[model samples]
Target: MSSVPIADHALLSDCRTAALVTLDGSVDWLCLPRFDAPSQFARLLDDEAGHWSIRPVERARASRRYLDDTMVLETSFRLSGAVVTLTDALATGGEDLGHGIGANSPHLLVRRLECSGGEAEVEIVFEPRPEYGLVRPVLSAVDGGIEVLGGADRMVLTSPVPMRVEEGTASVRLRLVPGRVLLFALHHSAAGRPPARVWPQGELAHRLERTAAAWRSWSELHQAYEGPWQDAVRQSGRVLQALTFQPSGAIVAAPTTSLPEGVGGERNWDYRFTWVRDASLTMDALWIAACPDEAAEFFSFLATAAGPPGEDLRLQIMFGVDGERDLTERVLPHLSGWRASSPVRVGNGAWDQHQIDVYGELLTAAHRLADYLTEIDEGTRGFLVACADAAAFHWREPDQGIWEVRGEPRHFLHSKVMCWAALDRAIDLADLLRARGRVPEWTRERDEIHREVLERGWNPEVGAFTQHYGSADLDAAALTMPITGFLPADDPRMLSTIDAVERRLTDGHGLVYRYLAPDGLPGREGAFLTCTFWLAHALALAGRTGRARAVFERALAQLNDVGLLAEEIIPSTGEHLGNFPQAFSHIGLVNAAWAISQAELPAGG
Candidate 1:
C-alpha cells in the first residue's frame, strides 16, 4: 500500500487535467488529456503502480507553495549546503493568445528546476504505466529525450540533460550549480496520432512565464472575494478552477479516486466524475467567490448532457467529462488499495441512483445565475421548468439522499427540503423571467411540500429535525436547512435542530459526522469536511457570530498545509482520509467564509 499521506501532495492543472506532485518531487497521480482519463502515474495507490520523480540525491527538507494566486506550484528543497526550487504546472495558452488558458489547448506537463543556492545533485526517474498500471510502456531514446510507446497512447519526454532508458524506465543524474536551470517537458498523444513536438530548452522559459501569467490573469478576473479569510477563500477558488474541465465548463468532484474514507476499509470511491449536485454547488460557490460565467457554461453543459426532459424528469446523477453517461463502477483487483483499503474502484455506481435532490440544486443554480446570464434560450428555460415540475411530482417518493447511501431508499429530510427548494427557486425564476403563468402549479406544490416537511420531517420529541421522516436520527445534512433558505436560521425549530446536531453529530472537536445511522457500508468513515463547514455557515446565519467564527476557524484548521481539503477528516487524528482537494469541501469553505464575513460586517457599512 502507498504510505504517502494525502496531504503531502499539491495539485497542478491546465484546466483540462490534473497532476498531484508530492513534496518529495514525485508525480504520483495524474490523468492525461482529461480529468477522468486513465492515469499514467498511479503511485498514490500502490508503490509499483508507476511514478516519475526528480529529487535530491541526499535527504533534503522541503517546503512548497503556489505561485501567487495561481495553480503553479513551487517547492523548494534544501540539502546540507544546497537548495533548489522545482516549479511544476500543466502548460496553458501563453500571452500571445490574448486570453487565459483554454481547455482545448495542448497537453503538456512542464517541470523546471533551478538551483537557488549553492549546488545540489538530483536524480530523475520516469516510469510510465498506462491503463492504470496494467500496461507497461516501451521506452526509447529519441532526439532530445525519450518516447514511451504503449497501447493506443504515446508520451514523449524532453529533458535538458542526457538520460538513459533501462527496462522501460528513464533515469538521470545531474549536478546543478547556482543560477543553473534544467527544463523538462512531457507531451501526450494517442498512439495513431502524430507525435507531439517536444519543447526546446530555450522556449521553455517563455512557456513557463506564459502559463503563470495566464493563471494570474484568470485569477484577477474571477476572484472578487475581499472578505475575511481572504487567502483561504481565494485559494479554494483557484483549486476549484483548476479542477474545472475548461472544454465543457464541468468541474469534477475531485481529481483522485478510491482514496479511502476510512483506513483499511471498503468505503473508498472514485470521485473524479461531475455530479449534478456537486456541479450545482460549485456554480453557487463560483458565483459568490469567482464569477457567473463559469456557472453559465456549466449549466449549458448540463442542458446538453442531460438532453431533453423526459416524461419521468429524472436526471442522471453524474456524467463523464465528455458528458458520457456510462459510469459503471468496476474494481481493479491488481492494485492494492491505499492503506490496504481494498477493491480500488474506478467508475462510480451512483450514476443510476434516483437522487431527487438534484432537481433542487440545478434549479437553485439556475435561479442564482439568472441575472448574470447573457441569454437563457427558451429550450434551457423550458428544461429548468421541467426540473421543477419533476421535483413537485417526486417529492413524495423515497430515494437515495445526498450521501448516496447504498442502503435502501428512505424519505430523507434533507431530500424533502431540497425538493421544496426546487419549487421555490423555480417559482422565483418564473417571476424573474415574467413567466409566472408557466409555474403556477409549482407554487402550490412548493407550499404543500413545505407544510409536509414541517409536519412529518420534524421530530419534536428529539427537539430536532430527523434524518428521515418519522425517525429520530440527527444528520449534519439537515444543517443545510438555513443555508438553503428553507427555514429562518433563528427559527425556534431550526435553532433546536442546530443545538441537537451539535449535541449528537459533532465529534466534540467541531468536526461533524454525516450521521450515525447504518449506511449499509461496512466501515465507519471520518467527519465530512463539507458538513463541518455547513455547521459553521448555519451558525453564522443564526446570528451566533462568536460561535460561528469559532466553528469556522476550527474547520479552517483542518485544511492541509497548502490550504487544500479532502472530502473527509479523521476527527481524532486530523488525517485527510478521502479524495484530496475535494471541490465540495472547498465550496463549503468559500460559502462558509462568505457567510462569516458578511455577518461580521457592520450593519449597512
Candidate 2:
C-alpha cells in the first residue's frame, strides 16, 4: 500500500480536474479530464497503481508551499550542498474570463525544475496506469516527449532530454548546475477524441506563467476577507474556488475519493460528487471568504441537473460533477486501498438517500443570494416553492439523518431544525419569488415544526437537545441550530446544549466528534474538523469570543504546511485521518472566522 501520509499531499487544480502531489514531487492521485473520471494515476490507493514521481536521487528534505495567491505549487528539495525548486500547476485557460476561472483549460499539468544553488541530481519516473492500473498503456518515444496510448485516455508527456522508455515506464536521471532549468508537462485527451500532441518547451513554460497569472487575477477580483486568521481564511477560499467545477458551477465535497476516515478501517467513501446538503453552507462560506461570483450560476446548474422537484417530495441528495444523477457505488477489488482500507469505491450510494435537510439548504442559499440572483423564471421559482413545500410536509417524518446512517431511519432533530429554516427563508423571499400567496401555508407548518422541536426535541434530564426526538445522544450537528438562527445562541436551551457538547462530545484537545452513538458502521471515525469549526462558530454567535478563538485555533493548528485541511483529524495522534483538503472543513473555517470577526466589531462602531 502507499505509505505517504495523507497530509503530505498538496492540491493542484485547473478547475476542471484535480491532482494531488506529495512533497517529494509525486503525482499519486489524478483523474484525467474531470474530477470524477477514471484515474490516470492511482498510486494514492495502491502500490502497483500508476504514479509519476520526480524526486532527488539522493536523500533530501522537501519544503513546499502554494505560490502566493495561486494554485501553483513550489517545492524546494535541499541536500548538503545542493538545492532545487520544483514548480507544478495544471494549466488554466490562461485568463479569468467574465464567467469563471480555468475556463477552456488545456488539460495540461506543467512541471518546472530550477537548480538554484550548487549542483544536484534527480530521477524521474514516468508511469501511466490508465483505468486505475487495470490497463498498461503502449509507450513509445515520440519527437519531443513520450506517447502514452491506450485505455480510456490518450496523453503525451513532454520531455526536454533523452530518456529510456520500456515496459510502459520511462526512466531518466539528470545532473544540473546552478541557473539550469528544465520544463516538462503532460497533455491529456479523451480516447478517440483529438490526437494528443507534445508541447514545445517554450510554450509549456509560457502556459505555466499564464496559469499563475490567471489564478492571481481571480484572487484579486474575488477574495476580500480581512479578519482574524486572515491567511487561513483566504487559503480556505482559494481551496473552495479550486474545488469548484467552473464550467457547471457545481462544487465537489472534496477532490479525492476512497481516502479513509481511519487507516486500516472501512469508513472510506467516494466524495468527488456534489451534494445538495452542501449547497447553502458552501454558498455562505463563499460569501465570507471568497466572493460568491457563481452563486446564480451554481443554483442554475442544480435546478437543471435535478430536473423537477419529485412529485413524492424527495430529491436526490447528490449528483455527479457533470450533472449525472446516477451515482451507483461499486468497488475495485483489484486495487488495494490507501493504507489497506479495503474496497475502494468510485460512486457514492448516498445519492438516493432521503436527506430532509437539502430543501432547507437550497432555499436558505437562494434567500442569501437575492442580490446576486438573476430574474427567477416560472419553472425555477416553482421548483424552489416545491422544495419549501416538501420540507414543510416532511419535517415530521422519520428519515435518514445528515450522517446518512445505513440502519433504520430516525427522526433526527437536525433535520427537523433545517426544515424549519427552509420555511423561514422561503417566507422571507416570497416577494422576490413572487409567491406571496403561499406564505400562509408555509407559516402553518413552519410554526408547527418550531413547537414540535421545542417540545419533543429537548430532554430536560439530558440537559441538552438530543440527536433524535427522544434519544439522549448529543450530536455535533446541534451546533447548527444556533448558527442557523433556529434559536438564539445564548438562549437557555441553546447554551445548555453547547455546554453539554463541549463537556461530552469533545476530545481532550477540544476537537468535536459527530456523536458517540453507534452509527451502523463497524469501526469508529475521527473528530470531524467541520464540527470543531461549528463549535467555534456557535460560540462566536453566543458572544463567547475567547473560547471561540481557542476552539478555532485548535482546528487551525491541524492545517498541514500548505494550509489545507482534511475531513477529520485523529485526535490523540494529531494526524489527518479523512479525505484531504475537504471542502466542508474549509467552508466551516471561513464561516466561523467571519462570525468571530462580526462578533469582534465594536458595539455601534
TM-score of each: 0.98, 0.98
Tens-digit lDDT string for candidate 2 (348-457) = 88888888988888888888787777575677777788888889878888889899988788999999999999999999999877879989999999999999999999
- lDDT per residue (tens digit) for residues 241-325 in model 1: 8888888878899999999999999888899999999989988888777775665667778878888975368888899887889
Model 2 lDDT on a 0 to 1 scale: 0.88
> What clash pairs does model 1 have?
none
* Reference-based lDDT, residue 341, model 1: 85
Please name the candidate that would achieve the greatest lDDT relative to the true structure: 2
Model 1: how far is 10 from its true place, Å?
A: 0.4
